[model samples]
Every structure is written in structure tokens, then in C-alpha cells.
Target: MRITWWGHATTTIEANGTRLLTDPVLTSRIAHLRRRRGPAPLPEAGECDAVLISHMHADHLHLTSLPLVAPDAALVVPRGAAKLIHADSGPAFSDRCIEVAPGNQVRIGSLDITTVTANHDGRRLPWSGHSGPAVGYRVEGAPSVWFAGDTDLYDELAAEAGPVDLALVPVGGWGPSLGPGHLDAVRAAEAVRRVRAKIAVPVHFGTFWPIGMDWVKPELFLPPGDKFKAAVDPEVRVELLEPGESIEVLA
Candidate 1:
């Protein structure tokens, strides 16, 4: 399988001649957040077979970004998310939206994808009506891969995902200090150990940040990947990719 990190939680996964995109925040800026590192996402990201939305958070489920995807690419969102997106974006995704909850499965070409639970709040807005089960994906093919959308460490982690060739785990957030329901370098390493993945990739870091705060502590953006590499078990190999960078995970 080939994986490309498109900055922040956006990633492209290609396997078995099919392409799957995850949490696509393709534009350079969303609301007040700006892409501080890496180039804007390329047009090729729009040409995928499916798009996986991990949750309802704006960064992950941007209504504006959804239209950029190929008209044929199915939008796999959390259960009940279609209503919110439909209400908020209106007619943006009337045709190709699939709502999935934890343990639900969907097939696209040769890959079989199963939704797994994530330990994060998936609220579309700060006030109310959160989406169901902020989830991750287990993409099964020749070389299976797990794209952990956004999560903190949870007890059922190991059993939920089983085994996979590659794991994409989030290690940081856009802000300087990560709050509850997030995994920093240390906890993400523990997640690596739990999932038993041969190769792990650190994501959700070194991408976007609030305006004006970029220079306050700039080094905070890029170090989570390296920190995760250092803290994970020595047996597990860590592959860190910058935005727009791709790596092949062998079976």
C-alpha cells in the first residue's frame, strides 16, 4: 500500500489499484487555521475512490473541502453525519455519502474497510449534536493499513484494530498544548505498542496552526513525529512523512 500525508489529518491511501482519502482538509486555510508547513494539497487528492471522514470536527470534515473530491469518490462519514453536513453544506453531498459507525464495514474495489472506535469527541460545533463514534479505519488488502483519524489512547485499542502492516496514528494537535482526548508523542508510542503494527506513521502534526501563534513556538509543529519515533518500542519501525510525501508500505 502507498500512503501520502497531505498535511494535518489529510492522507491518501492507495492499495489494490484503488485510492482512499482520509479526513481531507485540502485547502491552505480553514477558518482561522493556516497551513504553516508543506505545500497546499495537490489536485490529485481529489481523484480517489473513497474519502474517509474520521469525525465531525471541522478540520477533519470540512464541508468546503468535500466538493473538491472526485464526484465518484464515496464520502464515508460517521453515522448521522450526513444530516449535519446536509444541513450545514446543503446539496454539497446529496448523492455519494455513506454513514458508518464503529464495526461497520464498506468495500471499495479490492479493499475491505472496517470502522473502529476512536477516543475523541466528534462535535461539528462547540455547542451540540456531535457525530457518532469518532472512528478509525482498518483498510484490508495485500498490505493492510490502519488510519487512526484522531484519538487518544483507549483500553480496547489492541482488540479493536487487531493487526495491520501500517498504522497512521495522530501524535499532536494544531495548538501549542494538547488537551484531553489527544495523544502526544508518549501516548502515541504506547498506541504503537498496543496495535502491534510493523510500521507506524505519525500524523496530525506539523501542518496547520492558528494565525499569529506560528512564531510564538514554531518548533512545536515539527517535533512530534521525531518524538514518536524515539519513544515507540525499538521493534516497531516509524516512517514519518511531510505533507505531499508518499511512502510504500510493503507486505
Candidate 2:
């Protein structure tokens, strides 16, 4: 299986003759957030068999980026996403969107995706009236990969994920300080141990940042990946990749 980090939570996973994209943030700017590192996601990031959106957060599920996905690509989003993803402002993805709650499974090409719980708020906007449970995806293919979209460490994480060959975990956020419902380097390492993954990749770090804050806590912008790698148990291999970097793994 092959995985490429497209910056932040956006990633491309190629396995079992299928190409899947996760939480794609294709724009160079999203409100106050800007693509401070790595190149903006290219058009090919949208060239996939399916797209998995983890939550309703603008960064994770940009309404504008929805159209980038090939019209035929399956879109797996949280149950309450239709209203937000298909807002009247633009084209509707209602036809391609597959709403799912935790434990629900959907098939797209060679991948069987199972939704799992994530510890984070799933609201799109303060008054958007769209809300749902946050989730992670356990993609079963040639090499099972668990894409834990923005989440904190929860006790049932390992059990919910089942056996994973590669764990794509979030070790940091876009800001200097991560509030509740987020993972830091230490917690991310703990997650690696809990999931019992043979290999792990630290994501959601060194990517986007609040505009004008680049000079602040500069290290926070990109060091978390390495920090998480350093904290992980030696038994598990941690492959830390920069934005647009790729790695190949076997089940």
C-alpha cells in the first residue's frame, strides 16, 4: 500500500487497486487558516476512487473543495453532512454523498471503509444548524489503514479500530496550543501503542497555520511529526513524512 501526505489531515492512500483521499483541504486558504507549508493540494488529489470526510469542520470538509473530487468518486461523510456539504451556495453532492454513523460500513472499489468514533465536536459552524458525531475511518484493503481524523485519545480507540497495519494519527493542530479533544506528541504515541499498528504516520502537523502567526512558536508549525515519532514505542515503526511525501508499506 502507498500513502502520501498532502498536508494537514489531507492524505492520499493507494491500496488494493483503489485510490482514496482523506479530509482533503485543497484550498490555499480557509477563512483565517492558510497553507503555510507545503504546496497547495494539486488537482490529482481529487483524482481518486473515493473521498472520506471525517467531520464537518471547515478544514476537514471544505464545502468548496467537494467539487474537486471526481463526480463519480464516492464521498463518505458524517451522517449530518448533506446540509453542509451541499449547501445552496454551490453544486450538490447529495447524489454521491454516503452518510454514515459510527460502525457503519461502505464499499468503494477495492476498499471497505468502516466508520469509527472520534473525540471531537462535529459541528460545521456556530449557527449552521448542521451537527453530527465525529469519526475516523478504518479502511480495509491490501494493507489496512486507520485514518484518525482530528481526535484526542479515547480509551476504546484500539478496540474500535481492530487490527491496523498503518495508523495515520494526528499529533498536533494548526495552532501553537491544542485545546481539549486534540492529541499532542505524547498522546499520539500512546495511540500508536494502543492501536498496535505495525507502522504509523504522524499527520495534521507542519501544514496549515493561522495567517500572521507564522513567527509565533515556529517549531510548533512542523516539529510535532518528529516529536510524535520519537515518543512512539520502538516496537512499532513510525514513518514521519512531510507534506506531499509518500511511503509504501506492506500488510
Candidate 3:
């Protein structure tokens, strides 16, 4: 499988003749977070068979960016989150929605995707009703891949060793200090090692930053990926990719 990190949590995975984009934040800026590294994803990045939305946070599920992708691309979102997408992207996009929860499985083209549990809250807004489990995705193809949307390490992280060929784990966030349910560099490394992923790519860091607070702990932005790379087990290969960089993970 070929994976391209499109800054922040957005990524494009091409495998088994199908394309899948995760938490596509295509635009250069969203709200106060601006793209701090690499150029915005090109139009071709929108060419995907499916879009995997890990949760309802604007950073992960930017409603405006939904239309930016191919109209035919199915939006795979957390269960009960389809209404939010419908309200934001309209019925046209909602009609193609495939709502799923942890363990729920769906096939998109040749890819078999299984929704997995995440520790983060998935409410549409901070003030909105916060219920249900946040989610990540385990995509099965020639080489299975794990896309851990935005979560701190879970106790069952290593239940299955080496289950995935490649794991896309979040090492940090756009903010200076991370909150609960978000992994920093060290914790992210442990999570990857626990799963025994043959190859890992650090995401959710070094991409976007706050508009005016570049001076406030700027180390939290780009350094986390390097830290994660340094901390991962030597047995596991770490591919610390910059935004828009692609790597091929062989099965």
C-alpha cells in the first residue's frame, strides 16, 4: 500500500486499486489552525474511493473539505455522525455516507475497513452532546494498515502483536500542550511498539499550528514526529514523513 501524509491527520492511502483518504483537511487553513508545513494537497488528492472520518472534530472532519473530494467518494464516518455531515455538506454528500462504530466493517471497492475504538470524545462541538466512542480504522488490503485518528494509548493496544503492516499513529496535536486522549511523542511510540507494526508513520504533528501563537512552545509542532521516530522500537521501522510525503509499505 502507498500512503501519503497530507498534513495534520489527513492522509491518502492507495492500495488494492482503491484510494482512501483519512480525515481529509484539504484546505490550507481551518478556523484558527493554519497549514505550517508543506503545500496544501493537490486536486489529485481528492481522487479517492472513500474518505474515512475518525470523529466529529473540525480538524478531523472538516465539513467544507468534504465537497472538495470526489463526489463519488463515500464518507465513512462514526455512527450517528452522519447527521452532522448531512447538515454541513448537504444531502448529496450525506446520501453517500456510511456510518460505522467500533468493530463495524464495510467494504469500499477492494478494501475491507473495520472501525476501531478510540479513547477521544467524538462530539460535534465542545458544547454539543458528547457521547459514543470515538473511532479509528483498520483497513485490510494486501498490507493491512491502522489509522489511529486521535487518541492516547489504550490498555488493549498490544492485544495483537504485528497485526498491521503499517500503522499511522498520532504523535501530537496542533496545540502546544495536548489534552486527555491525545498521545505525545513518547506515548505514541509505545503504542506503535505495542502493536508491533512493521512500519509506522507519525502524523497529527508538524502540519498545522495556531495562527498567532507560533512562539508559544513551537517545539510541540514539528519536534513530536522526530521524537516519535527516535522513541519507536528498533525492531519497527519508522517513516517520519513530512506533509505530502509518500511511502510504500510492502506486505
TM-score of each: 0.96, 0.96, 0.96
Higher-ranked by lDDT: 1 or 2: 1
Across 106-166, the per-residue lDDT of candidate 2 in tens digits comes to 9988788999999999887766788999999999876788999988988899899857889
Q: How many clashes in each structure?
A: 0, 0, 0
Encode model 3's per-residue lDDT on 1-251: one tens digit a residue.
79999989999999879999999999999899888899999998899999999999989989878879998899998887778767766899889999999879999999889888888978877666634568999988778888999988877666532377789999999988899989999998888877778889999998888899988998898889889988988888899887878998777
- Taken over the whole model, the C-alpha lDDT of each candidate is 0.87, 0.87, 0.87
Candidate 1, residue 159: how far the Cα is off, in Å = 0.4
lDDT, candidate 3, at 145: 89
Model 2 weakest 10-residue run by lDDT: 83-92
Candidate achieving the largest lDDT: 1
Candidate 3 residue-pair clash tally: 0
What residue runs in model 2 are displaced by over 4 Å at the alpha carbon?
A: 88-91
For every candidate, C-alpha RMSD to the true structure in Å: 1.3, 1.3, 1.4
Candidate 1 structure quality by residue, lDDT tens digits, 63-142: 88888899878889998788887787676584578999989999987789999999998777676575577999999877
